[model samples]
Target: MTTATMSKPSVGFEKLSMRGVTRSYAKAAAPALSHLDLELARGEFVALLGPSGCGKSTALACMAGLQPLTSGSIWRDDVRLDTLPPEKRGFGMVFQNYALFPHMSVQKNVEFGLSMRRVPKAQRHERALRALKMVQLEEHAGKLPSQLSGGQQQRVAIARALAIDPEIVLMDEPLSNLDAALRIEMRTEIKRLYQERGLTVLYVTHDQEEALSLATRLVVLRKGVLEQTGTPQEVYTNPASAYVAGFMGYRNLFPAKVENTGPGDDISVVAHGTVLHGTSRAASGTANGAAVSVAIRPEDLVVAGQSTGNSIKAMAEVVEYHGRELSVQARTGPDTVLHLKTNEPVVAGAVLHLGVVPDRVLVYPADDGEETVQPHV
Candidate 1:
């Protein structure tokens, strides 16, 4: 059987690309990665995103040549990358643990790669200091990693990666170990470096917000399979499937049937004896009575005073006070619970009239057997 592949728009020079890449452990029934095809253009910040164990790290490892693919090939333009070893691939790597030698000073750690390559000591020292300056750590060059804070240590790691002047940089959750404040600080630093140096970066992260904020494009995976690939706006505003919509933080998902579809793209769906009308974003026609899944974000549901023919009457069950908004849990129907976000404060045990904007609802073809829904708060 032929393998399935995903293609990207070739706007610039293609720096790294993978085709039908799969990695399977011994005796494991399923592969860690399955026929995944992806590409990275020159200077693009691409984020490999998914939940834990979804093969984000494995994919990054394969790209760095740390782990060989069980099948398929990786390429840098016409050059096959699978034939090279990790050291020979010339791709810089930043780890979550900040892999720096404690015994070595920050400058020495940054210059280690150059020293290993047998470069002249003078040139190595110069490049190391340059990298340190780039990360704004030149003053800390004499200090050891243990002397610096977590954020500073991460900067040293980044400087070390940049010291080699590699064509590509691969990061495996580099900010996962840092505290909330430091993570935000490092995120800005990384973006600054990306802009200043124009590095082609492939970052692996489980944090959807991180990927959405940092990446030029996002490749989302689930169960080792490619769910969707698009820019943050494209994926967040228009998820292609229920799985992707859930992953992107859509809390309201329901199983329904297509009761009718109007010529102007208006769609009517029914669930548990409740009929809802909305507009369909999909261009493909759906036959009447076809089973489908409808997804909506909590923020998209507006709280109104009365039912506007398309509105539903829901009683508030719980109210969570966020700094800027309130998260209200309400029961809309006998079997349906809806989560809505509003700037207005809502008290528990109060009744709320909710209306969903027609164009905001997304409808997808239903899965055949079991349906999986991930609700995020």
Candidate 2:
């Protein structure tokens, strides 16, 4: 029956789960989370990514046993986590603010967790030194958090988390407080640390690029619902829905109306008061007489002087030159504007030709997230 017991525990015993969990605030219109089902493999990093109010951080709190789940359960490995207290959950957390004690030296901060648990004093000091070395901050062990740069403080926070040798690590937008360059640098640093330790991490962030870069499995959520979950490439290359598609880098979405179905099935869309064709399969079987939206990514757009597969004549409205590439914003006939990222340059207002590969397009039901049409099976 696989009754959630006596199962093998992977490294650090880091399995994580949320089953039918819900959270509601009395004054809010809806639950902060609804029937959420999330799973993280013992050693894999799963990123909880979404916009504000989307239940990502809430889910993390539930798993950490910091906040009570309104319903259902949370678990780590084969044990029910909601049954335990925050400390009993065997979780280590690093917040966005790098919550370290201002008065404590780096070594003391890292040893605090172990000290709380009554670890042998000698062992605690040894583990703390090792944790500081892991983050390359052993030399700063004598300095306080106030004396460190933002990045260094964050690293100390990481060292503190690692000192406990926790069953799992939960990070909530830990790099959000850093500047752009530091953020990029820390992203690589954290990736390396996680890999070296084989740590299971559940990270929460609203940064699409960050999730795309770090997650072994990325979960995209919206308005308290799970939109999609997949490997970064799979989520980006083949989104499960429009909401998820947008998060995966699609920027040029056009409203489409499905008109027919067959080998020569004709879908219809209006641009500049003119009807355009070239849609592949109607997303929904009922799309024949229904409305839908088609998504085309900026990189998938082809710019030139003639029409091609699912091509549209977009008046080059604006152009911005980025170092290695050009950014193009064009009005495709008037109703919609399409954005393209290209290495090539073309004059603005040139009415250049642009085409989207049918296979690369993502179609969504017009009503917006109420329904999803999976690609033909």
Candidate 3:
């Protein structure tokens, strides 16, 4: 692989805006994406994150012109973008599959987009080699896709996308096919490319951790509707709704009734016959006896010592040793189970008093027909 730096692509835009973007298929019961309004600033790394069928990929496809919108418009700065064809839009795309030509050499694959654009042969060759070098795969330029590993092929796909010097790169779960270790390695490589090239990216993924670690901002969707949009820190620390809170690794979620509103966004609630205090985004005007849901992350639960602000007494039903801590599933009521983690050695059937800081607990208005939190497999 060559280490020589290539000239940066001259592409910059103030913002790319999507206004009420909606897509529907005749055979489908509902639209795949619905009324999505989003904006991407120059050089921003935005991740579209959610579970399967949450419209993340659909949104990317709509933006890439692979799928036509049912109703809505996309704009680049002041220019209307949805009116243009995919090739004419001047955007690069990487798919979940590497999507490389099996018969073509790696260099030829990287040069295909340029060739389509009628770039000169000499210029396309130089750009292809430079793009390959960017991915550290220039040495494999002559090899067919069949000869390279999954990671190398993915890199070649990335190089192919970058070779076109697109204004924005749209990635649809590009790393989902790679193994766990390769996924991490490619994440670093992609981040480096984004920072070094100052590339604007709109990425799609169902993995929460991937989005949290790589994205400058996260756009979370549910059933084709936009759920929340915020920085990773903001979303992880303070989710806008119970659905988002469950998706963000809040393992324990249960129904609670608001008891009173305290000073400064603090709220008191009663769950499973125990009183608990937590911070609420809607605490300012929350009425007493209002239905609410309480969410707490497993790592935030601690074995109670002397201080007891919010405490629950339960019997541990299952205990498993993690590398650095013990994971416990405790039963607090006939139908209530709470998951928590602690550093202390614990065994099944042991009585444990779990406590959580008020700030760590999140309270949201109760949602009807909300899905339970499922462990990510």
**For candidate 3, what is the TM-score?**
0.90
Look at candidate 3 and tell me the lDDT of residue 217: 96
lDDT tens string, model 2, 327-373? Answer: 98888654678888887777687777777666666556674544332
Which residues of candidate 2, in runs, are more than 4 Å off? 1-14, 120-126, 133-139, 263-283, 333-335, 369-377
Highest-TM-score candidate: 3
Q: In each prediction, how many residue pairs overlap at the backbone (N, C-alpha, C within less than 3 A)?
A: 0, 0, 0
RMSD of 1: 6.7
lDDT of 2 at 296: 72
* Candidate 3 residue spans exceeding 4 A from truth: 1-4, 119-140, 146-152, 372-377
Please give, for residues 21-75, the per-residue lDDT of candidate 1 as tens digits. Answer: 9999999889999999999989889998887778888899888887889998999
lDDT of each: 0.82, 0.75, 0.87
lDDT at position 313, candidate 3: 81
| TM-score of candidate 1 to 2 decimals | 0.86
Model 2: per-residue Cα lDDT at residue 41: 79
Off by over 4 Å in 1: 1-14, 118-153, 280-284, 333-335, 368-377
lDDT of 3 by residue, 130-183 (tens): 888877788999999999988788888988998887768999888876778868
